[model samples]
Target: MKLQKVLSALVTVLMVALLVVATSASTSAQEPKQNDGEDQTNLDTQLYLIVATNQSVADEKLPAALDSVVKQLRATLPFKNYRLAATLLNRVKNEGRLDLSWIGAPIISAQSEVSPLTPSFSSFKIRVVKLAKNTAGETVVQMAGFNFGARFPIQTMSVASANAVPVINYENTGLQTDISIREGEPVIVGTLNVGPSGDAIILVVSAKRTSR
Candidate 1:
């Protein structure tokens, strides 16, 4: 009887070990496997909008209608005769939806002899409403609105006040209408005026499409 009991205990141990292994194998099979090219197929494309302001200074006093508020800028600004004002980026899809992003705080430098005049409100927000290929086979981007505060310096005082809120509609085409931007590419659309005087706050815009 003692020998029979020992043999039964050994059989139970072997059964338990086999059951554990089967359970582990089942779990492994249920786990999902990743495809080698999955990352490439699921890559996303992004769009970026770069905005820079150019201020033109005249030696004589600016006209009353011409609102002038100048601020010194870093010598390392990208474009000549323009300051690195603001930059914004957005991810675009073909879903026909609008995208909005806030621009960084205005970089207002103190007045200097070199660049003493600048715009009051240096920063604003932009809305990209639509993107499509037109009949001309051009990639056109429709801007829903450009919301910004119109600031004018208080006469004889250093303080500035918000005068008006303006929303403007704009449209532009791709750099090369013949070439489609499947990968990363940049195109300069156009320029806009932010100040009361013409060209006071010149907004230089460039659109870029990139894939990740």
Candidate 2:
């Protein structure tokens, strides 16, 4: 009888050991999966910036206006990428997922303080003129901006007769032989046929200087 009782106790202990081992194995398997899930969640939480601008401006006006600012951040900051979206002010305010943004004037003034980053611009200029203003009264064929760093000019041409010119005005020559104006470092020359309004131009220069 004593031997039988001993055998029963041994059996119980073995069963308990087996149960403990099974539970430990299950826990170990579940832990790795749970850890992986958490790692993925962290990756999803990684920050990305969303840049938004107003749609009221013609689409053509936007790329140049904002690209300089975006490029600054891309050069300096640590972010995956920036995405441009045209969204209403209220919609932007309500989104919990917006990590960073480059918004228009209205949104910038309103929500910039609360955002993770503040938007700023690089020195740039925009000139618009009628195509008839060029020397020799020829139709303005292209607009040029001189980037001093590159020591070359960025020239763009428009078809609707109205040329949008952005010049990097290093020389400060005003409305010379070429129908162009000075930005900061590069001079912008305008071309094309739309200059009848006598060359209405807008120049936007920023306070920040890019490092060499």
Candidate 3:
């Protein structure tokens, strides 16, 4: 009888061990994946902020990178000249968020300007950035809540006296929208009017997939 009882206990222990192993295996299978391609694709995006104006400056020459765009702008825009004001670059992973702010944009200074110009404050953001293949099997970047904003300084009044400080004011320009563009292609997100002069600011965005 003792032997029979011992055999039954052994069988129960074996069943318990099997149940534990099965539970562990099921849990492991249900866990989330790591470093999956769906979430690992990454890219670097370049942002160019160009100022278009009718005012002629000493340096009318723009960046060589924007040669094609300059021609297009000259054809479409009423402004006779264009100059690069700022360029921002950032890298983000698929399904990621990018947010940045700075006080680094060049102040609006035309030719023969004597007073100092205030530094421009700017911000850029993308709430959700993703990399995906399109219908043509080409990779594109999709962005939600893409936004750009800036506060540009303008000289309200020149100093009347040596003891008097220059009166200044600020003008705002920017846009916000969702966008999707193919990799390595530069896109103009939006155009905005800035400062007292009839100058316009054009935003260009270029993206390249750097990793998968």
Q: Which candidate achieves the best lDDT against the true structure?
A: 3
lDDT of each: 0.38, 0.30, 0.81
Q: Per-residue lDDT of 1-113 in model 3, one digit per residue for the tens?
A: 99999999999999999999999999999998785545566889889988888886644677676777778787888987787877888999878999999886344555455
Deviation (Å) of 87 in candidate 3: 1.2
135, model 1: CA deviation in Å?
A: 2.2
lDDT of 1 by residue, 22-137 (tens): 99999999999878753232212223222333445323332221122112122333322443344444454432233343323323321342122423333333343344576777
- Candidate 2 has a TM-score of 0.21
Q: Could you tell me every candidate's TM-score relative to the true structure? A: 0.34, 0.21, 0.75
Select the stronger candidate by lDDT from 2 and 3: 3
- Sorting all predicted structures by lDDT, with the top scorer first, yields 3, 1, 2
Taking every candidate in turn, the Cα RMSD to the unseen true structure, in Å, is 12.5, 21.6, 4.1
In model 1, the worst 10-residue window by lDDT is 65-74
Off by over 4 Å in 3: 1-38, 59-64, 111-117, 133-138
- Candidate 1, residue 14: Cα displacement in angstroms equals 41
Error of 3 at 66 (Å): 2.6
